[model samples]
Target: MIPQRKLSLLSNRLARKGGRRVPEAVLERDYCLSWFLVGLSKTPLIDILAFKGGTAIKKCYIPDYRFSEDLDFTLRESVPFEKIQAYLALAFENVEKDSGIKIRISRFDQNVLGLTDLPDSGL
Candidate 1:
């Protein structure tokens, strides 16, 4: 769990640096989602997919990369939608239970191809 003081300090520092208010909820949402992605990456399911884009960079490659609002991946081959959904459902459940942060997953036909949409977390 992230310390409340640490989170407060982060938000304060960010707000000062950017010359604007940094909502603590946004920080916490990003933190929670990143934690959930960490758990997702450990699975064999994700190993078959090629992670890409800014969110992938932030989570998998560059820790200090810029903030990204979305996750992207490329599949070498097709997998059943239900399989993908089930794996993520279990993973998100574990993440929520452990972190005490609810992660809601849903598909909205907003992105092209197989891009799965992450629903509003209501953070």
Candidate 2:
């Protein structure tokens, strides 16, 4: 499990980077990937709480922010955090391979998952 202090530090860093509020496409991708991963482990989605830029989406409302580059999703209960991380890693790798853009996944817990872009290497 990721420590709370570390998570807070990471969040602060991302916020300071001016990461865009998550976009709808990212949200949809996250939902689909999350369901698939959780289903593989037979975990159920009891609830989802999206803090910050996610409040609108959680409420089934449209988001006001455009160009959102980060997404934060909170699951209802805990599960094997490593498994979730593995699933997300694989998912992001696939997306990167397909889109030719680097995608990175980080998980604090079964409850919290983050997706972000990788810095361009100019390769």
Candidate 3:
């Protein structure tokens, strides 16, 4: 896991470079978003998931694009909701093991998953 202090330092440097404010919360979210996507992709879910949304645009096309607080994906194939939930659970478990970040799914639906970071996670 990237230390919180390191993330703060990086955000500070980016903010200093462009004179644009870099919110620490956004940095934290971005960090989690990246690791979550990586972990998710390693699962079978990758076959069905298609990355999209503002975050994807920012990552693949425009580094300076607006910061996004969440990850968005579209399913390319149909899967039972129960199976999707199971896959998501596996993904979350993988993320925790790999990144040391405890993320709770605060809410979820067919098209959205809202994640919340546990407090004092050491980033």
Instruction: Give the winner by TM-score.
Output: 3
Q: Between the candidate structures 1 and 3, which one is better when assessed by lDDT?
A: 3
Per-residue lDDT, model 3, residue 73, is: 80
Over all chains combined, what TM-score does candidate 1 have?
A: 0.67
Off by over 4 Å in 2: 1-52, 55-60, 63-69, 105-123
**In lDDT terms, which candidate is top?**
3
The reply for model 1, stretches above 4 Å from the true place, is 1-6, 15-22, 109-123
Poorest lDDT segment (10 consecutive residues) of candidate 1: 108-117
C-alpha RMSD of each candidate structure in angstroms: 9.0, 17.6, 11.4
Q: Write the per-residue lDDT of candidate 1 for residues 1-123, one digit (tens) a residue.
A: 678888899999987887765677767768876777766765656766777898888776786667776667666667777777787787777777767766786663323444465666799
Candidate lDDT scores, in order, read 0.72, 0.45, 0.84
In what order do the candidates fall by lDDT, top score first? 3, 1, 2
| Cα shift from native, residue 119, model 3 (Å) | 44
**Candidate 2, residues 10-113: lDDT per residue as tens digits?**
55664566554333344545444434333323322223322345533533355344333444455544556666566656655654444444454453433233
